[model samples]
Target: MTFKGVHRLLLLVFMGLALAGCQTEDTPAKPQFVSTTSDSRNSNYFIEFRSRYALSYGHTYVVFGRTDGSGQMINPEVAGLHPKSTSAVPYVIGHFVPVPAETGWSDGDLEEPYRSASWRVMLSQAEYNKVVRKIRDLQANSKFWQAALYNCNAFTGDVARSMGYSVPPIQLRPQEFVTKLREMNEGRRSVSPSRVLTAS
Candidate 1:
């Protein structure tokens, strides 16, 4: 053919490719907020954070479900420790509470003197495992818990990072840390605001 005939053929092909691209763009991607299950359907885990008022500086902790959806709470064990326990050679430990579902306390009823908020994590099963293992391993190490330094807030932050989540690096009080986490998770498919059960 001639030059004009060649030009017309090229234009038609370009228009066809553009239309195909537009069609592909019209299709929506699947939502990532839903929980991912393993081959045996064993992923009933949910990562959660709990924040409550404290006389000193407020408190924050991480909660998660067992493979069966049972609740477990982990926090630095410093409240009842004797002053001598944190003396010259300060020592701190962790408290792991595996709550029974039958108890109404699972919702975090702190009564008067305290208020709380929670957030549920929406991530894949594999990611959930990473988060859980991180917390559990830390819980097992008595050296990892420090009443002043590697406190519960730090613990939560570590777990969040292990799960591929991010929070501000600034030094934050417990409640502030919890608030920051919620803010960071806003609109993210990997996390969601959870029910807040307040007693006072």
Candidate 2:
């Protein structure tokens, strides 16, 4: 082969190697969603639009209504309850809702008046992972709930925001946040709370 031809072949080989290196360097690994196997019943949960709500570790799993029409957090031991065919399925509400303090009210007064209502939502493993990741991210960054109140519901809203969902103000009343989540989940384009209120 001529010297010039040999030089051209070397250049081509060098270019190929550089291209291969660039491709390898630019490729990103597939993102792995959070683990679903950690909790067994996670898969059966259905994603649905309902009244807005939140989830947290403290209010891990709760039965929101009667067994005939209720939802519970996914757990390894108990199969989650859903709405009966004949009845409206009770929601699987998260623990993120804040519990109000009892202010000198009688037990009877507290029992009927202050009981918070909840709705349910079931999420697939991927969706659950997304929510979990968002929550962890917010917990790592914020102090709003650290000292004043440990509002899981607000934390859940923060997570929702991280997942690209429009959320109400981070400092909103629990009912308002719930209203916003419900609205957003139902394909509504509601205004997000001002970003100023969210934790940095």
Candidate 3:
């Protein structure tokens, strides 16, 4: 072959290799969970379980059947399921402030102070186990759950989508999902919000 033709061929080969490298770099990396020592983290493998659990309420229900029998003194359903046992009680206390004792109450009566906004039901041991198993399964296979996110619920939906399940129509679009998630994360939205507010 002519020298010029040989040079052109070499240049094309180099260009092809460069393009291939670019394509590889452009592809998204696999998702991973954040490391955490909290019991709540253990419950969901520390991968933004609160949002993931909330988003997958159906799964949550299946895992943690509606009952409180763990004797942990805090209910997962009302307090929010945590991977770590210690974290679970505190989480409930923080979110749902316990009602103070009556003015005449003695020191002994302090143990069972009422919760101002206690959850209606706590998850039984069987239910808690179910939740743990489901979370493990999601961690093992749910890609959306793995992705890093400023908003964890969005990540949960993304994982659901990755699993080939259609996300809720309300969460089909990213913007909508993010908006709803933000409200939930901020504690503005609830299962029963006093007033529904639309995103601007």
Candidate 4:
């Protein structure tokens, strides 16, 4: 192809991406997950580890259910640790001291546009209900977010642990945390990471 032809192709690609980004800048994208359970019929329950960009470092959360949509559409349940106030002040303060936290969904969490990585695992009906109960208990008990102590990653780890999954050290960033969780439990069953994270 001529130089002009190549240039035009690249321009079109860039423009298409730009338009797509703008359209989703304020909306949540629907989540599409493929269950790892061999028996798709019996495995209607699932929990997905997800990561997305955030101002401090990044954020990680879980989306659960047999939901067919996201945002307000399917309204799948989500759990993550985040400052109760959306303002940046409390978050910055939390680095040194614990601040109020909310354990449920936050804006953009259900959206795929901001996601960096995802790993999903299927669960049996009994396990699914148990995990949901654990999540709710954690939310009620967890009232603060502290960077060095308890934060989003810690919150996620606690939820995964209830399902008998081996959890990495909570100091790692959100993206790394979810990636490591999946790697540790590769067989769709609770297992261990090849190497544990000793330090951040």
List TM-scores for all candidates, in order.
0.48, 0.35, 0.22, 0.72
Model 4, runs deviating above 4 Å = 1-41, 68-73, 191-200
Pick by lDDT: which candidate is best? 4
In candidate 2, list every pair of residues with a backbone clash.
Answer: 46-122, 83-89, 91-120, 92-120, 96-152, 96-153
Q: Rate the local accuracy (lDDT) of all candidates.
A: 0.44, 0.32, 0.27, 0.68
Which ranking of candidates, highest TM-score first? 4, 1, 2, 3
How many clashes show up per model? Answer: 0, 6, 12, 1
What lDDT tens digits, residue by residue, belong to model 2 across residues 16-133?
4323312311112112111112232335543221121222111111221111224433331111111112221211111122222211112221122322322234345565555555
Q: In candidate 3, what are the lDDT values of residues 91-169, reduced to their tens digit?
A: 2332222221111111111122211111111223443454455545544443321111111233344433332223332
lDDT of each residue in 67-109, candidate 1, tens digit only? 3344233331211111123232432122211111110121232
Question: Model 4 reaches what TM-score against the true structure?
Answer: 0.72
Please, what are the lDDT tens digits per residue for candidate 4 over residues 91-194?
77776568999998998887666786677666566666777888889989999987767878889989888766778867666666677777776564541233
What's model 4's lDDT at 145? 89
Better of 2 and 3 by lDDT: 2
Candidate ranking under lDDT, highest first, comes to 4, 1, 2, 3
Which 10-residue span in candidate 3 carries the lowest summed lDDT?
53-62
